[model samples]
Target: MHVPHHPAFPKAPRLPAASLPLALAIPLLLTACGQKPGEAGHGMMMPPTEVSIVTVTPKEVPIEFEYVGQIAGSREVEVRSRVSGLIEKRLFTEGNRIKAGQALYQIDPAPFAAQLAAAEADEAMAKARLAQAERDLTRLKPLIEAKATSQKEADDATSAVDIAKAALKAAEARRTAAKLDMDHAVVTAPMDGVIGKTLKEQGSLVSAQGDSLLATMAQTNPAHVQFGVAEAEQGRVQQELASGELKLADKGFNVKVLLSNGSVYRETGHLDFSDYKADPATGTYAARASLANPDGKLAPGQFVRVLLMGASRPAALVVPQRSVLEGPTGKYVYVVGKGKDGNPAAEPRPVVVGDWVRLDGEVKNGWVIKQGLKAGDQVIVDGVARIFMPGTPVKPVAAGAQSAPPAPAAKS
Candidate 1:
């Protein structure tokens, strides 16, 4: 074959076998590089991304705060022996509900009984001596008045009577103490509660001075939930309340509990107490809620999640938490607005968020927008990943709606 070549175009050198494959691939690679994989050809533009959006509207939204809490009894008491003695028997079953004044342990009463008997005998002897002193004084009074006995003798008899009276009082006091000790030998529950295991076993010697703890009991009815609020969080809430951004219920917060199994407690509670001083250990203010636990479902020392309700944000703007993105400047959200060409576009809008809130009838949480957003602004809730850059044109679709087809590709 005859080929003509001009001086301006040089003849190509022959490639080796290995280099020939690469040489042949150069043209195909150049053709592939000229057009994007998904594009029909060069200069064809990609369709606008489809995104789900929520319209911003000012409405009263209920706000809830959650904290890690623990279940506790309204009253916890340590069962101890009031008198020193050996534990004769365990009267109450371990881990059982007990009533106030119910006998829990029977301490050895033999020694107490013996002491009481001795006191009674001493009291009886004192009574006899007192009677004799009174009789002698009575006899001396008449004798002295009739001049049958000396005045000194009558005075001595009266002194003896006074001494006897003092002795009697001392004996009576001892006897009463002995009787009380005898009664205390039987240890009883101080309040109605669920009793824990006995600390002192049978035949264990317990004393009032030390080692007196026999068991522990806690009142389960009207169960109390103890939780802490961080000092920073408290301050933030106060500021919000002061600015009229948050409104609390007139009564107080209505509390609900989340069990470990992820179920809500049947009974609701109310805020009973909140400490003014911060806890030294936790740097949080202590708060408590009281709930009716008639069925004894709540146990002491159980961990739970506390939900504090009865607060709401009035006429506030909110968006899904996922919609808020953190950029180099601050937190922002993509808002669907009209571009210069009158097409829908995603624009980055900086926002100041106050608190995380769960909307009514919604499971997921949302951010309460404090600033930089107004009512009727369309905020993109989903498909934000598709927005590669600010001011990217988008197809706005209502949340939970069928997505519209992508705009037809622009003709080259």
Candidate 2:
């Protein structure tokens, strides 16, 4: 048989059976031991994850205490009828601002007027009697000196004159009282303020001692915010003040009022009043702040939030709230630290948190770390959830990037 050798088909050299198996196993061994060109030892190593971090810097932060408050008039006055009469007319409009001594209601003056006229008539009659008695005494004095009248008659005449004088004085006193009743028939505002709805309407019978309620007026220009603080907290504040740890401005404790609509009031207020003792039932101390409310924007009974300032936390360690995590045991945070190999790793750190600090009036950004954290520690703020386990390698980047710098520790 003639065998043709082609360029594409190369002839294989024949080998012994045992040696052939070894030759075939050589390629298998090389394929099993060799690594791909792009691959490194073992396998490709993943790069550290990029994360946002906030550096913990201890600084002086203002300690702000917020309490729910109720708005009220600085001065509240209850309008009442001073004399009994029929309400003739409502002099002031409801919900209108009124001035002190402004007429609020007109009561019927017919009865009071009649009483004054009767008193005047009595006074007139008493004066006529007094004049007659005086003329009699004048006649008696001359008669007694002339011996035409008995001494007892002169004495009786003098006594009658004195009695007449006393009666006239009593009549005058009654007239004055009647005049006062007439004046009091008209109810007036006690202080300048907005008047509430009329309690006694027209044609209703009102009296000074009976059902005298007419209306209510409140001075709103300088509004008051009433709030209560836990007695324990107040005691702590007082202790701090005594220790000279907290200092107040010349005007005293400054207060900020936050409206229910989440807007801050323009004018600040001052703490003017505080109850001497804590309420036994509530365990709180009552307090009040006076704020300027010329525009009448703050209404009585309006709910608000009052923030007390002027105290500070010295060297407070604060971090962004986003860096905190809730675990099975308690709250924890990831701190950027060097791992075993000197690579940056996320280390789980337990921390005790304090009150929240609002960076802007609208949103809360950072919170106080009372324990387990110190100054100059890099805390992972963003990309915390990306880390599945502690000691995971990470690349730290500053938070807020170019848009905003790290949130500063708030003073108040």
Which predicted model would earn the best TM-score?
Answer: 2
Reference-based lDDT, each prediction: 0.88, 0.85
**Whole-structure CA lDDT of model 2:** 0.85
TM-score of each: 0.77, 0.79
Whole-model lDDT, model 1: 0.88
Which stretches in model 1 have alpha-carbon errors above 4 Å?
1-53, 320-334, 343-352, 381-412
Question: What tens-digit string does per-residue lDDT give for candidate 2 at 161-181?
Answer: 999999999999999999999
TM-score of 1: 0.77
Worst 10 residues of 1 by lDDT: 1-10
Error of 1 at 97 (Å): 0.9
Candidate 2 local lDDT, residue 237: 81
How many angstroms is residue 147 displaced in model 2 relative to the true structure, after the best TM-score fit?
8.5
lDDT of 1 by residue, 1-412 (tens): 4344422223445678999888777567656688434455544466788999999999888889999999999999899899998899999899999999998989899999999999999999999999999998887877888999887888899999999999999999999999999999988889988999888899899989988999899999999999999999999999989999889989879999999999899999999999999999989999999999998989999999999999999888988898898866688888988888789999878899977887645474788898989999999999888775666789898998996455898799
